[model samples]
Target: MKAFRLEELEAQRAANQGAYLQFLRERNMSVGLYALDAGQADPQQPHGQDEVYFVVSGRASVTVGDETETVARGSVVYVPAGVVHRFHHITEDLKVLVVFSPPES
Candidate 1:
């Protein structure tokens, strides 16, 4: 079993681009913590594997292809493999738990 604390991970914001702390990695899947400050843009591209985003705190507008939705704490969003998606109009500091299947490379 593995354990993680968000507060500890948040303190490791070593870059202005937000903090991406990967905590769990297995043969079939991986999990990570992503924290982005308000007004910051997400610099991510489409992934080769399916992914799920579990919002741990804060709020944001997430765009998956042509559809956009407001997400907050406890919200879960899914993006299929190779889909275009991004977070914008961040109204609050966004802290999310990211899960990727097939273990992203």
Candidate 2:
């Protein structure tokens, strides 16, 4: 089993963008915890793999295609392959559980 402390992961943010914490990665999937600070939005791009997002803490507004939804703790969102989606308005340091099938990276 592998374990990663949140504090340790938080210290390794991707230098090119907003902060992120990757906890695990394997051949077919990737799992991680992410934090989106208030007013932050990652670039939107279409991916060839399925993506699932579960709001672990705080709140966020997610846009998928022409639809947008407010997701908070316990809320879940799915993005199928090729869907154009992005996250935003991450108030209060939103924490999210992210899973990607056929891991992009």
TM-score of each: 0.90, 0.78
Cand. 1 TM to true fold: 0.90
Per-residue CA lDDT of candidate 1, range 6-42, in tens? Answer: 7766666444344687778999999888887899999
TM-score of candidate 2 against the unseen true structure: 0.78
**Best candidate, TM-score-wise?**
1
Residue 41 lDDT, candidate 1, scale 0-100: 93
Error of 1 at 80 (Å): 0.4
Clashing pairs for model 2 are none
lDDT of 1 at 36: 77
Model 2, 7-42: lDDT tens per residue?
566666545355556678899998877777777777
